[model samples]
Target chain A: MQSARADAAARLADMGLPGRRDEYWRWTNPAPFMAEAVPEAGAFRADTPIFADMPKVRLVFTDGVFDAAASDDPRLAGVEIARLADAPQWAGAFYGSLEASGQAPVRRPFAALNTARASDGVMLRVTGRAARPVHISYRQSSDTSEAILHHCVKLEEGAELTLLETGTAAARANLVLEVDVGAGARFHHIRPQGRSHGHRVYSAIFARISAGALFKSFTLSMNGRLTRNEAMIEIVGDNALAHIAGAALGDGADGDFHHDDTVFITHGAEGGESRQVFKKVLRHGATGIFQGKILVQPGAQKTDGYQISQALMLDDLCQFLAKPELEIYADDVKCSHGSTTGAIDETALFYLRSRGVPREEAVSLLVLSFLADAIAEIDDEAIAAEILARLQDWLARHRG
Target chain B: MLEIKNLHVKLQEEEKVILKGVNLHVGAGQVHAIMGPNGSGKSTLSYVLSGREGYEVTAGSATLLGQDLLALDPEERAAAGLFLAFQYPVEIPGVGNMVFLRTALNAQRKARNEPEVSAGEFLKLVREKAKTLKIDAEMLKRPVNVGFSGGEKKRNEILQMAVLEPRMCVLDETDSGLDVDAMKLVADGVNALRDAGRSFLVITHYQRLLDHIAPDVVHIMADGRIIRTGGPDLALEVEKNGYADLLAGVL
Candidate 1:
């Protein structure tokens, strides 16, 4: 194991940061983060936390370090929280195992690097249904700050949890989250990346599900200099279900902003189901990319999988690139994937205008419609509505 | 309430002329029907009046209630009491029908410096108008025009017309995709909204719609020109003898 770690560190050092030549990094060049000196983070004051109204246990992280004095009590009913350095034996077992297992068939050097340098993150274990959600908020304090956070989560049998994450961590951030869902357990994740234009974020989620486990994740990415979010999910037990969805918006004019969503789901057990839905709205020379795939193993009969990635480009200068793939080794499995990129439907726009809707409002309506499908994937209505309001604000400010 | 003089229009992308030297006038409280064969520019005339894009008006003057309709944007024209019922209503998958109607009503009201309608008031108004058109609450709750049948689409358009209550309404082939029952339902909806303060321009390829709507005046349009103007009898004459004889006589 020590030799493997050394090998991984050496490989990451040799590869340095991902470049345009990397297959998955072709559309998004990671050269900005590869510089020897990280850029200064502009000072920002977040108006309010995303789920300020929601009754949740809050954990605050400042400059990649846990801020215990500013957070809720570590003790809560049916839930256990521990800082990575002081986590229990059971929690430490899952800290890096799942993430390491995910680096197969495809190499994510950023994730590997994140594991090597992660300073601090939370370890959460749900023994039973959590009475309230767990909210993690990140706050940056330094201009040239760099944050590496790796979170490990484990849900015992029949346990349920909802995790809400928000805020910008730093000027440059590398995040890895690993989850283990036991039999008959359910896990819900909702993350609204702060609308900060100066941050460069590379994040990944590695999740594994057992029999009859349910896992759903929804991510909303607003404006950022460069953001690449990767998710890898494995349904390892029969009758397990997993769904991953994202909605992103990029409205930068100088061509310095880009957002990418890359996801892979594997069905290794019978009767497993998985779904991936991603939508992006780009304008003013901003770029968006989606690369998603579903794999059904040989014995994974009765596997049901679906994947769709679509983009609504608000102008000709904006670009959207998508690659959807499905691989089935079982004869009785059902799998499908589709990708589409288009402008706002002109006919719909004309209809709205003819009905007395102004051009700007009409465009806003169309943009919301384009994102409705992905937003619907969020399980919590209140959270979904909040995210929707944030998206509307973004649209209003970036209207052409 | 609507007037056009020597209207000449051409496709924006192509050099072909659509409406050439056409003149027509519709009086207040009057229902005028324009009958023509395919490729005769009936739809083009309606589009031009509603301020649709992709058309260049080379020579024309159009007025709605003494306002220069051509100078206004589509939404402005709508706010200025002009409405066009599309032959094919657009389907917006996420915008609710009720939301769309309320937004439109409030938008026009705001443009005219009138107070915006309250949600309760708007709902009551929509329910009342939709009841006349047989549009149920369920249909109103669905996305605009999505999954609606052809008959339902036409009725929705009429419901919109009733809710908007514009001074000048243009119907472009509203009868094309309707059965006898649906056509009568639509006609009834249109008739209920008729008043001395409003006028209508109903464009159709056949005279069937005129029979139900009872136009006060009928005109024969061909080759991008209104060759003949007559009373309601002209519609019946063309309906029976067909445009073949009318074209022959004109030639």
Candidate 2:
């Protein structure tokens, strides 16, 4: 475990920190993150925290430190959970493996910095279907706290698990989640992030899927100043599926909102499938960016990959930038990538207004419809409904 | 109880005029048909009445139940008991049919200071109205007009009309793309909503739709103006002789 941390530190030192000149960080400025001291952010106490009523194994993190008294016991059927400081051997072996393997083709410097510095996270080992979801609630209590957290999950063959993460971590947050899906296993992850005032988030997810395994993750982001979310996934086993989707609503009242989604998925085995769907709604000079790629390795025949990123700009002041790429090294593969930046459909708006819906209400409805594709990725009915309600609330609060 | 006196309109993007001195009077419990040639400003009247943007109402006055129709916004017009069944219903993907219907219904009710219906009541009303148009549950569950066939789109329009229950309805060439059976279904849906307090202005190019809905009066329009006004016999004459004769007669 120590050696793995050392190697991650060395990797971070080699890559150094990303600058504006870096090809991957060209669209998103890295100046705020590169500052010697983390920027100060105000602490926000959520009035009604997300997933508060859900039945689950709750883990509470206050200002990047675990709060055992505020959390439910970390015990569930068919699962073993431990903090990173007391990680089991199985988790220690696979902790940095996925994150390291994902570094190739594109360098993720923030993820490396997280792996090298993170000391607060949960390690989960699932050998069978978990009784319920594991909900991680990140509650920030200190206004100037900077959090670096890393989580590793190992799912044994034929096992199943669902992970739900919500709320902001600290004034500034750097989170790395590494997942290993075993053969025939299933993993579902849903995260609703960042309602804190002007908080910045840089998060990454690195996952590997084995034969016949299923891995799906979705994110819903709102009310964040600067957010950069990256995901690197690999399908190393035949006939596996990996899906990742996100929906972000950004309203820069004074031109402070910026959100970016960067993703790379690799297909390394025959009959592998992957999908990346992301949608962002920006208004009032907010900026949205998307950089996604699908790579099919040699001998990875019969791979199916799809990627789409779309932005709905409410006003001419808003900005949207996208770069979609697909590199195929094998024959007999099906892959498609599309990126679109457009304004609201005037025809649709007129149709709604003609049907008696007010302009504001109609715009909100259309915005929700635009995000429906990405939100549809969540299979859980209750969770999806919760996300929809939160989105409606946000739209109502930030009316035009 | 709808009146339009010397209504003139032109495109906002260009200087081309569309409707010139259009005069229409639709009384309560009456169904009037406006039969005209292509570009005769048949659809333009419907759009202008519904307050669609990109139209400059140069000189006109339209009143619905003695209220200024031209003064309100599009949504305000809708809430004031006016509905237009589009010739080409816009496809709105990801907005579920049921949800859209409920939202429109509730919005109108709210605007009119009436209590909004509960979800159960809305669902029941929608299902009952949709069944008449032969719109199955699956179609209602899908997005509004998305992936719908031509007939299905027409039927969806009628379903919306039935659900909203407006006082004055305008059908702008609703029979453009429909087979006989589908047309019958749509016509049946429209007829079921007919009441003494509700009136309709059925716009079409042929007498075929009038055969189903059976308008009380038919007006022949040509060159942005109504050329002739008569009973149902006038529509048959134009359908038989074609709009060229009507256009010639107007000239």
Candidate 3:
């Protein structure tokens, strides 16, 4: 473990920090993250816990440091679990493995930095269906704390597991999650970051899926000063499925709010299906960016790839930027990509208002309707309900 | 139920006059038909009464049950019991028809300081109303007016009217794109909603629609003014001799 850490540190030193001159960081500036200093953010308060109704194994982290007193034992999850620092020999091959594979053709310097510096995280290996979900709660109570977390998960053949990451991590957070899905296994990830006004967040997910495996991930984010999310997925075996979705609402009424999602998906085997759906509602000078690509290598036949990113701007002050790319080396594949930025339909608004809905309420309905496509990707009914409620709550307080 | 006095309006962008000193009155329990040619300001009147934007009411007053209608927003006017069945119903892509109806009904109820209808009650009410218009369950679950045919859209407008139960309703060319069977079905739906306290302003280009809706009074509008007003016979004369001849007689 220590040897892998030293290798990652040396690799980070060679690559250095990201800058605005880089193609990936042009739309979103990297100045706030390049220095050795951690930026300041206001602390957040929540009235209720997310996913409060579900049975789960909970791990609590306050300002990047794990709190044993506030968390449930990982053994209660009915899965093999250990702290990342104290992980057994099985974790050595999977810790930085997928993240290193994702570095080629693209370099996420922050992810490498996280691998080198993260002090504490969780390692879970699921051999059978887990009795309960593993919920990682990043609860923050500090205004200037910086957190670096590196978590890894491995699912054995015919295994099933669900992992959830929620709450505001810290004033500044760099998180990296590496996952390996064995044959005939399934993995689900649902993360809804808590809103903090001045926070800066950078997170990445790297996964390798085997044949006959299923992987689904959804994220919901609303309030943050700056956020960048990157996802790199590889379907190395036939008959695998991968779905990634995100919904973000940017409110720049205060000062600055920008969110970016950059995704890359590769198909290496036949009969693989992948989809990417991302939607954002921006208002009052906020900005949203999307850079997504799908790659089908030789002999990867019968691959179905779909990507859509749309932004509904409430006013003229907001803007959206997108770059959608599709690369194919096989002739027997179907792939489509689309991106659009538009304002609320005036005619539709008048129709709603004429039917007795107030302007604010009508606007909220339309915004939610815009996000419905992305939210529909979640397969769990209970989880989708909780997300819908939070989305409604956001729209109510955002009415201006 | 609705009174318009010296209502003058113009296109906000072009500054061109559309409604020139239009005056009309619709009494409770009565059905009035306004017949006119294209660009005669017939549609503008409905839009102005419903408080749609881009129309400047330079002068005039529209009162609903003695309350000023022009002073309120469009939604407020709706809460005040005014409804307009659009000439071309707008299509909302992601809002289900059932959800839209319930939201509209509940919103009006809440605005009027009444208790909201529960989901079960709303569902029962909508199914009852939707069945009368020949709208099936699939149509109710689909997005509002999205992928619906022309006749389906018009019927959806009537379904909304029935559910909202407004006091004064304006049918703006609701018979424009309907076949005979669809027209009769829609006419029956409108007829079912008529009562002693509800009034209707039926604006159409042909008298054939009036034959089914059976207006008590008919008015001929030309160049943004009501040129003639009489009993139902006036619509027949206009339909027979055409608006050019009627304008000649009035001028």
Candidate topping lDDT: 2
What lDDT tens digits, residue by residue, belong to model 1 across residues A33-61?
Answer: 66778776653464345788888999999
A290-371 per-residue lDDT for model 3 (tens digits): 9998999999999999999999999999999999999999999999999999999887888899999999999998997899
Ranking of candidates on DockQ, top first:
2, 1, 3
In order of appearance, the predictions have TM-scores of 0.95, 0.98, 0.94
RMSD of 3: 2.3
- All candidates: CA RMSD in angstroms? 2.3, 1.2, 2.3
Better candidate by lDDT, 2 or 3 = 2
TM-score, chain A, per candidate? 0.95, 0.98, 0.98
Q: In DockQ terms, which candidate is top?
A: 2
Go through the candidates in order and give each one's DockQ.
0.75, 0.82, 0.67
Ten contiguous residues with the weakest lDDT in model 3 chain B? B91-100
Q: Could you give me the TM-score of model 1 versus the true structure?
A: 0.95
User: In model 3 chain A, where is the ten-residue run with the lowest total lDDT?
Assistant: A41-50
Supply the TM-score for candidate 2: 0.98
lDDT (C-alpha, whole model) for all candidates = 0.89, 0.91, 0.90
Q: Which is the leading candidate under TM-score?
A: 2
